[model samples]
Target: MSSSTLFSPLTFGDFKIPHRVVMAPMTRSRSAQPGNVPTESMATYYAQRAGAAFIVSEATQITPQGQGYSFTPGIYSAEQVAGWRGVTDAVHAAGGRMVLQLWHVGRMSHPVFQQGQAPVAPSALAPNAQVWIVDEHGQGGMVDCPVPRALTVSEIRAIVNDYYTAAANALAAGFDGVEIHAANGYLIDSFLRSGSNLRTDAYGGSIEKRLRFLDEVTDAVVDAVGAARVGVRLSPHITQRGMHCPDMIVTTLKAARRLSDKGIAYLHFAEADWDDAPPVPESFRRDVRRAFGGAIGVAGGYTEARAQAVIRAGWADWVAFGRPFIANPDLPARLRNHLPLTVPDTHTLFGGDERGYTDYPNAG
Candidate 1:
């Protein structure tokens, strides 16, 4: 057996995890159409990977307005909640704990998904990003995002309430907890970065003002389901899709401190994972550790050795793996046994049937 700390157990909020391997939230876009509900195939897919210490489910939209990609699941309607209940039940029956990731895409959406209306953001700024969209003919392609309209203050508060409702729905659907998707260049991330949020209102201007929306959303989710059941995902170093904020590091650190004060369960960082992506500085990692006292998780391109190094240094409590878990359902077992991982077929990464979803075999 590997003598790495990655196999060590740790107390994370409500549950005591067996290892430091976390199945990161990945968007596969395989939800049933017309209502964007979870399917039986998704349940099998997650249940097959139940050997992980814990799973952070795919990004589930809080409302229809939060959807940016095609075929992604939601947690808004009763039918959707029932659909997820099946998935969570399967995971739990397989002896695993799972958390639902609540998401709002904001300006990352297209008019086609927005009912011919412009998408809403903190300001009327376009991220110049593209979201995967499927047309009436069932053809999927990347579509450029258009400029969004600034959200009224009342509308912002309504979105916060939407998060609260989503958290409640997650618990009702049998989720162990809910992770607020405040990462990437999504709605909450845009509000945090000065480059996208040019609003002169109470929701923008200074860093504190920009953080107000996230604070309210977190508070609302905490109210819906206690602080121990809440986690926040932030991407301070991911400067893609027009998310170049000069003061993002500082803003993220301040947000981390506030989330710590709220007594949230964990704070996850979605670092840039591409081969050429800039590395997350060690100084910033140290600073974040000082800022947030709760469990800290990080997701990027982490290998076993790298994950062990970070955990040993006390920089992160756990390591979340994304693509690695796609083709290797029994990822934790494979890693522990030093087995070779199966490579995922890129063509079937999103919006596909079970060919690439649950077809991977365990290394028995």
Candidate 2:
């Protein structure tokens, strides 16, 4: 059990990574105009950090209905697909692998951002925290979440198809794979959380029923992109966007055990919160590893020591660095060379130019 093991090669499906370092999905919200397409600058941003064994891009909305924020990328339209082609090509040129994050924000959106359209969710519940609403010019404004309208069974089916269409679009765009965003209290997470989903239909009520939305979407994505190229991003036992389950550990195990049987390339688990999330107790990570022998990548506030510990302990196949990678684009090299690290500018964390996005110093 040593820190060096974190940098070891690990195989996930057909992709054999030279290291266990992964760049987690980050919401840079920097996509260029008209449908929030990926830009050339973003390509340079990702290509610079191509050293990661795996790179999951920021949340890409499935469609206009799936979008919850402005200036974020999407995979629904042909133009959007073409835009991402530039990114995928750049990452490949740099010898890196990248996966597109498929997302739907559910009640996390504002009417102001969605062309005055009301947000939709499993129930008409409002999120406990307020979302940052963006104006036409992408100006950030704070507003309390409005109660969302419950989707009918038919609309739910349409939403599922939206995910499929986006997955197909992702493949056509030349992405290596797709990661379904089933966490962070998004649409899938909203339906998964008992606090958010209060319906008594086949899509809600019991744990088995509650997990249906996520399962259907996963099956659709896998079918469209092949399971080997489809990964899942899940935040279990964590209360982001006011997620609370009666018994998270039990619920998650029951839901995920079946997913493990379905043969996904990997499971990217966000065990806890960024600030107050409880530590991933030895037992929790071990249990997941035992349940799914497939590749498992863990993310959160972690150091080189902690990342290596998880890998050495055989609890996780890879470790994803969030803010550390934000401040240090050359994080893998920095860790390998034991270079100095800089503190990220909190103010520039969201909505800014290259000052904090692609301008991070490299380990020369």
Candidate 3:
């Protein structure tokens, strides 16, 4: 057995996971078309990586309106729930746990996916980001996002209800828990930042007002399920897609405190992973640790050594890996044994068949 802290057991309330190596959520865009349902191939793909302590599933839209990219799965429909049931069953049968990530793209979307209607956001702002869109002829490419229409107060409440329904649906689909995707310049993230959310209503303006949407969604989800099975993700350091805000770090810390007060199971930080990305400061990590008492997890470009170092520093309870898990199905075992990892095919990272998805063999 490995002696590293990464191999050590950790508890998130009711869940006493065997290791601290988590499988971070990644958008692979390989769901079945037309209905955007999870497929048997997806079940196999997740089952192959059951070695992770627990898997946080790819970002799944809570409602049709939440979808941004082509072929990403949804959790709102019965067919989608049934499809995910198969995936959860496969993961559980393989002796692993998984959580569904609830997502809404907000302004990071195109009208093509919005039924020719403008995408919705806290304010009418464009992300200056592009999302992968598939044309009618089955070709996919990046497309620019247009300015979104501002969501009214009633509509904002409706989205919170949508999150509640999605959380309940996730439980019905056999997932162990659910993670609110409030990071990455998505709907909830936009509301938290001043730049994207210029609304003067109860949902925006001051930092406290800005956190109302996230608080309501968190409350709704916690009420739908329970505090023990809910996790919230936040990205305070990310500045891309016009998400930068002078008060983001303070806002994130305050949000963390609120989430902690709500008794959520964990707080996950989705750090920027680009090669030139600024480092997530240890001071910030310490501040978050003080703000939230629950298990704290982080995901970016983490190698085994880096993961181990973070855990040893006492700043994080678990370290989530994204790309490394793509090519290494038996990642925990490989890290435990100090085996070389297989690099994933970059071209096949999103929207493809089993070639780069599940064909990568586990180390024997």
Residue range 1-364, candidate 3, lDDT tens digits:
2244999998885577999989999999999978999999999999999989999999999998999999999999999999999999999999999999999999888898889999999999999999999899888899999999999999999999999999999999999999999999999999999989999989989999999999999999999989999999999999889998999999999999999999999999999898888899989998999999899999999888888988888888999999999999999999999999999999988897998999999999
| Candidate 1 worst ten-residue window by lDDT | 1-10
Two-way lDDT contest, 2 vs 3, winner: 3
TM-scores of the models, in the order given: 0.98, 0.95, 0.98
Instruction: Give one digit per residue, the lDDT tens place, for model 2 in 174-263.
Output: 889999998888999889879899989999998899989988999999889888888888887678577887766666776668678888
Q: Rate the local accuracy (lDDT) of all candidates.
A: 0.93, 0.84, 0.93
Q: In model 2, where do residues sit more than 4 Å from their true spots?
A: 1-4, 136-138, 273-276
How far is each candidate from the true structure, as Cα RMSD in Å? 1.7, 1.7, 1.7
Clashing pairs in 1: none
Root-mean-square deviation of candidate 2: 1.7
State, as a TM-score between 0 and 1, how close model 2 is to the true structure: 0.95
Q: Considering lDDT, which of the candidate structures 1 and 2 is the better prediction for this target?
A: 1
Model 2: lDDT to the true structure: 0.84
